[model samples]
Target: MTSATRPQLEPRISSFRQNGMRTDALVLSEPGGKFKYKKITLRDNLLEPDECLVRIKATGICHTDLNFASKDRGQPENFPCVLGHEGAGTVIKVGSWVEDIAVGDEVIVTFTSCAQCRNCETGFPGYCDRWFKYNLGFSRFDGTQTIEDPKSKKPLKGHFFGQSSFAREIIVCETALVVIPAPTPAYELLAPLACGVMTGAGAMLNIVKPQPHQSVCVLGVGSVGLSAIMALKTLARPPRRIIALDILSSRLELAKKYGATHGINTTYQKDLMPTLMEITKGAGVDATIDCVGLPKVVEQIVHGTARRGRIVAVGVGLLTNAVSINTFEAVQAGLVYQGSLQGDSDPKRFLPWLLKMNQQGKFPYDELITTYHVEEVAEAIKDIKEGRTVKAVLLWDTH
Candidate 1:
């Protein structure tokens, strides 16, 4: 039946929920394809009791988003995807089961998780058992698609991190929401906090927890590494030294603004251990974070830290790359090697805290962000890939 002849959708939200509204999206028709702005359908399904309609005000480009949009790992779920996870917007409609949140509320959209998982129940949704299925599944957790291509009417993937907010508007899982309080923060500024900022800050505040006299080294001066520096520096009694290392001299200099006491341009520095030892006064770094995830960088950081120091890995490299840890050296040195996801954060608690800190001027992040119109997503992606922009935030033209 034609939409002109069908019964009128009841509520304003139903018009979008039932009949599949035409909306703006940066669509990737196939894995490794270029993202082009096009019209897409919002899908013709009723919103579940736990869902809500959101108009994306701002969304940040993440490495994960780009990686998935540009690669095909031979997964059946690959291709025809919309990929933006760090989303911030205003709620336009609510589901029957949702009570705490309401229309007109400003919100930050984050990843989804099954409430039944042990991790979820214990406040670590980042490690949820269904995390991959619900967040990275492209489709809904049940393998259903909420978005369709207008012409082909073929199902295109949405719900990347439960929001697929590369589009102008989206319907998201209630579990993925974190409401912003009155005196609301800027949506564009808060967007990256949904993931990258949270991941980096959480690693320091939650995992690293560097001591006042200890030394912390960050092996990448991207958004994540900078956030880690800012976070540890914001501590009441911060570590004695925070080292920032990156191939780009620009990024290494930018890290100094955040809190890094020493900046190392890895491209020019042939050996890091000598510099690390000199900076630590021969004690070596007490903690090291590998945000680059390259084998060489990881190995260098692993060997540069002092005995019994913590070595944390947060970067995502090639799927085929195996992180070969030298078991004997690790055991002999009493070093700890660990992998962290989303900075081991529970978004419900962590995001809000980050916001409060931001408001207090202790965790300033504006310096790292660069904004663009949603239509200029291509430019934003390119700038981030080339290291010209630390964080690319896309602003939707809602009108």
Candidate 2:
């Protein structure tokens, strides 16, 4: 119930291998609370026929992790759960049925999906039919928790997004694993590509697919927005102008460095729509991406898009918040507004492409990372919330 009560639930083993191969993890015992590092004993014979065990080298601290931990984006029942998804690691063990991946393979663990679903079969696993249940349900498909308290024998919800890599190790389904070649970039740098980076870059490259000479604007120039800017720069015929908007001047400057042609500090602007229109010369941008997901931000982007333009909402905001839109104006302008998840990426195909881009210095997403040891996760979260870091990755001492 409180941080003071954490000691009672302290793991009996100090090291993961001490008691049947349990591992260290930052567990949230209460809703809207701080993460307390504790050891957790995973289920015996943990590998399901379709699952594999991974020794996490690093994991990115995504806003979604913080949102779920803070009870801002998910149900409170998920409390006392291991919350993390952007993970990269080495396959330490594999299920008997895994054919494509083997032990010792380097992989990025992403959101899970039922391969047989209509959306997944159609190549859009981000919109998988069991998406909510698999990724956010805090349990396996058959309703089993992966870790439990040793003393009380109570289930501590695990499998958040199919692999709760906030721990030193995790058990993940084969479908959620994206194998990459060895001798690649450092795990800490590549960890974010599993989620935030993919979501931003994938949205622009895969969904928006901006035409040459078209104008585009990205709101909330954080990790996702900046990734969008970097990805846009690689276009064979890049957009005529790439606009970056944020309340922070520092992020706006980073946006410019990354490739944004114009930067707008929303803090200084009385009305974003007017400034956006002025920048696009009253024609409005061809594509406007709302990466902040605030209702007000969504409404403002709707007002700033040109006729036949597309407005992509990538940010995850409160479910109860609603944005008001003028139906007549939207119909008259022929504007299209849609939402994207994980950039609508098929990670198996997209991660490798992104890795190649990064290797060529075209993506340069590594420049955005600021690393922290697993124990310093709280500090990393603070830096992110205060806009001091574009991306924070937690490096694990799994060796």
Candidate 3:
């Protein structure tokens, strides 16, 4: 073909390694502080041989994000950090050694793990040996930051949960990227599937895996609880009854819309055990999932479980807090209490499965989303705390 007739090729986009870029991010300057909007210059060290740069499209505001932002969770190592884990975006740059994914691929950024660990090798990245260091350590596995403050000229912690995605762009490890189909829905609606939605639904489907016609009581009807309810509906023979307990009547009502057979407004009841027992006909529930990490709530739910019933603690709480349980009573009832992280999900397999279920209308997780521009992140967090939004997604105009 003649040169004139040959198609013109698009110029290759500049990458962080070649030409470092600056972008806007919501920064937390101190512990228990508000996220300040600022333009940050990404450090040249952002990319590693096994990393890739993602242009963030949408990021979910998870309760875990709020907890890290608002409380001194004893992880001072991660303070003054960029906090966000549930991110969905397009890959814009790949390091020299990155082969599994490349530029232009759509992906969900999730928790990172050492693939060689026993748990990860066995399909449980959530329980990776280096879970705390990789996800909550703020920096990369080697303790390095990818972003810096322009004025202070100091490193700002990044790589949170393998992708500090509260910004317009992020540097993430290759393992953290879960590629999704090209024709998927808007990124905003798919972001939560990376964390909150997956955690809740996976806890039920993967970890709990409740038997058919059994009774289940979900404590705290937030995104996680609602997700559990939605997953329950997909079972060939779902639980006999799905009870939702939350202080907010609106959340309880929303729970019903998903699949809850009963709603318990805990605020009106002095004790939750009585109401839960009554709902289970004095036998208590066959399974209880505590989405509220409070010790008191865990105690109540522990007491409300029937003989041989299982209780899964799905909530995150203060590090110093501990739940007091009567060992004798638990043993007598053959009650099982376990803690689940990220719903025991193997994101690669689970995420695609979830997307397929969502496409089939078996999982309507999008119904819980409330979108806001990136600048309105603070307002979105407030709405989440006030029980106004089930899931708040921050949309970035990366276009």
Candidate 4:
């Protein structure tokens, strides 16, 4: 969308306080730079009329974090930005307009959106017209920034996913905070639900909606992929065959533990379509939830689906990337290829449900996580990029 037509957010930064609040944050200094855990200060008074201060207890490392951090140095969201979004924490304070959510309440932080938009009103907040402006602009919608270097007065951009949970403390908008009750679950177990885990589960159950007689395939059996597998298993009449595709054998095995009926290591097996068709016993896959958004992967699977099969893309890829579709094939084969964000989930309602399912042992999302101290950010990044960890949860107490 063009800037002229895009929604312009009103400046929402609160007034300046006599003293700024200081806290720890993993600051990305440049494109391809290492994450440095350091001190950052909130520029203005904490919390707008509809905002709250959250002391981040745990945050998950996601592919989107890596994708944005590797973005060019000159962009608004690049260079000296804070980037974690899958955050779970406690509300330390609330703004005047905030209700239901109070100080000391547990919460999960997720993407924010304009609540009045058509998409939001119609149960698709992830597609809100101002979604990019609010969640990805790296600042308050009105072009104002919330974070800055306390020492050198250096400029830093944050407000990522409305919380920028990479920091120890954050002033988050009410739209991004989903409150949980007392006797809260462990933050490590809840962090990923804010985005990664939630996306997979919601995509499988909410969007894909695989039936008992159908066959489903999940590409990239990482945390998100595994979540989809588990969600599929939760169905009283789940799909007949749940195929898990990944490059790593370990992750494939992990997918099986979460209910994947078949595991295929794509790294070793080059021809995927034939193998998938064979596994489905000559019937193409009925539903495909792509956790990997590579162009080639998408192109190949487009023809491996059954007539009327659904392919849902929930992977976080660069905006510049595009996947070409064969119009005739799509029409003739009765294919449905769609894009999704956060599994089109309303975090306020969906996360609580996921947590409930988790409590019942029906959705063991916590099993995918590998904890790392906030200070060990580098190691976590390395492991995730190298497939050593399905989900890395960073805790605040270490540093």
Candidate 5:
């Protein structure tokens, strides 16, 4: 799947006029290995009445997309899947049932939730009963697609994370939409907000909710960890000591810039727990977040957390990965362990709030961005995996 030999799956301009609706999409033909340029197919077609046809300007490439396209993870996606979850675009068309949204509206596509579910009513759609399919099942809530492969003329899944937006257009549910201020940088940053950034920041603001002068430790300063650092800075009353631990020295430096009061580079540190304890003056951190998700890393975090501190697991470890904690110690110390998804936020409110924070310079998340063209996706993923960059955004300029 070299770039030179990658297939050029183009949209049929003639088809745009044939249907009452006009939209384009990128389709993933297979998911057995790294998603090469060849897997993407761009096609213009009609979107359904229950959908909001969107003209995507920019989309974020995430590690999850890489993992979804890879065979290493179980439950491989059905081929010819549309593989993008984070998108910022203009609403070119709206469905009949959707009265709140009008054509030409700007939106940053976020989570997929069954709006009528009890969990959603309580503002926890990430746990929506139908979330398995609506978010990552790679299909619409009805298990259908509004886009198709022009050549085969076959139905393709178009609603990954409620918006499979790897192309110029996507059809999304109005309920899953998050309206953002126009001309914002969501074009570059929206994707991270959808998953990676949300997970990290949410853990801090939503789960841990650290108090003023409290101490906190963040493990693995990758995209998620850096976000936690950013969230800490924006806190109304920040933790007295924010410690960042990671194997990468470069990311640790970025962590410092993002508001980490102390950074422990694991490579140089003889023992991470001991170093963390010394930084906290033996009192230990009030809370610890394990953003790496590896069992060993999680164990270290468990060991480093303060006696009565909270430990939040924000990383996506392999399903087989497991961590052990002493029940007696946990009972005696009163440790709290929690697992959070998408920051435990209702995207409808959170994305807009985050955007406002960014605009106010309170959440200057732009520092994490390293942009790339869609073709550079592989390189971007490589950089992210090797810790050369925190986030990689894909700008689709095919007008």
Candidate 6:
């Protein structure tokens, strides 16, 4: 066959070298369902000269990933999409247009931003004007794909969250990359910091800004809420009382360890608003942050905030879900209820700031981890859904 007529490779069917041996990952058709793990292959997209390719060392499974696959949440991306937003990897190739990021640099992929928008320029890229297409739109901000199916050569979606990182290799914008210190266990720690930890901790430390002697209640004790608890401890005049509410007993214990002064078992409490009121002596909490966004839970919070208090809802709820609030109470109580994105954080600055906190044993965010091998991803998801683990991480390094 002439060169002009040569067949192109499929999106998820490209060759790679593991210890100098050629290998390939199969890109199967979408099965259309929930986020269940199945064995899949990683493909090399033979990136353009101006693009950079990364060898993913680890990619943490996030609730966002699960939501994308959920029918209720309505992930716009069709089936066969490679889903992973929290990824850390080493740069393996650099395009001609790329300069700052070079081969062998360790980095994390964060929220995609225009970097030109007012919000992005102000260091809040979570609200970037073009984020829908830049991140969730399932292509580069410019609408393009890096990989193609090996056989059919059809374009495959790349750059989910600026890096479709579930596979072994990912292509990303030089600007989206955040370089970390070399040999810094980029696998386990970098992913959570990308979104979950940042959202939880940032909401408390950056958005809510709890004052001394105030009462704060965190409504969910998962990874996000746990991070919030830890962040609270670092603040001057941390909440005099930090209440963590969850149905699980073990998570509540972990909450106390992280800085929560009290843990409420909703299974026994039955009525959350009353319990919250009782805990705060009927004054209501100074701040109530809901890391879980079920309608019922949000409703309880609408009723739980003290007069002039703040309610920071950090969790990602279903797009269809809505909560009704009493306008009279909202006005009479002077409540400041607001939704937070990326905990109102600037990843370029916040990621490093958090690393320092972890190194000093001040964050203890690592304690929330339950590690697993990359191949055992399904089990990790199962553990998280079953409440057997708070957060599950896939470890790429045996060490």
Q: What is the C-alpha lDDT of each candidate?
A: 0.83, 0.85, 0.85, 0.84, 0.74, 0.74
Candidate 1, poorest ten consecutive residues by summed lDDT: 8-17
What candidate 2 gets wrong by more than 4 Å, as runs, is 1-20
Error of 2 at 227 (Å): 0.4
RMSD (CA, Å), candidate 4 to true, equals 3.9
Q: How accurate is candidate 2 locally (lDDT)?
A: 0.85
Q: Model 3, 342: alpha-carbon shift in Å?
A: 0.4
For model 5, the stretches where C-alpha displacement exceeds 4 angstroms are 1-27, 36-49, 268-270
Score candidate 5 by lDDT.
0.74
For each candidate, how many residue pairs have backbone atoms clashing (under 3 Å)? 0, 0, 0, 0, 1, 14
Q: Which residue segments of model 4 deviate by more than 4 Å?
A: 1-17, 44-46, 71-77
For model 4 the local lDDT of residue 335 reads 92
lDDT of 6 at 398: 60
Worst 10 residues of 6 by lDDT: 17-26
User: What's the lDDT for residue 362 in model 1?
Assistant: 88
Distance from true location, Cα of 388 in model 3, Å: 1.3
* Candidate 1: segments with Cα more than 4 A from true spot: 1-18, 72-77
Scored by lDDT, model 1 comes in at: 0.83
Model 5 scores a TM of 0.87
For model 6, the superposed segments whose C-alpha errors exceed 4 Å read 1-51, 74-77, 397-399
- TM per candidate: 0.92, 0.93, 0.93, 0.94, 0.87, 0.87
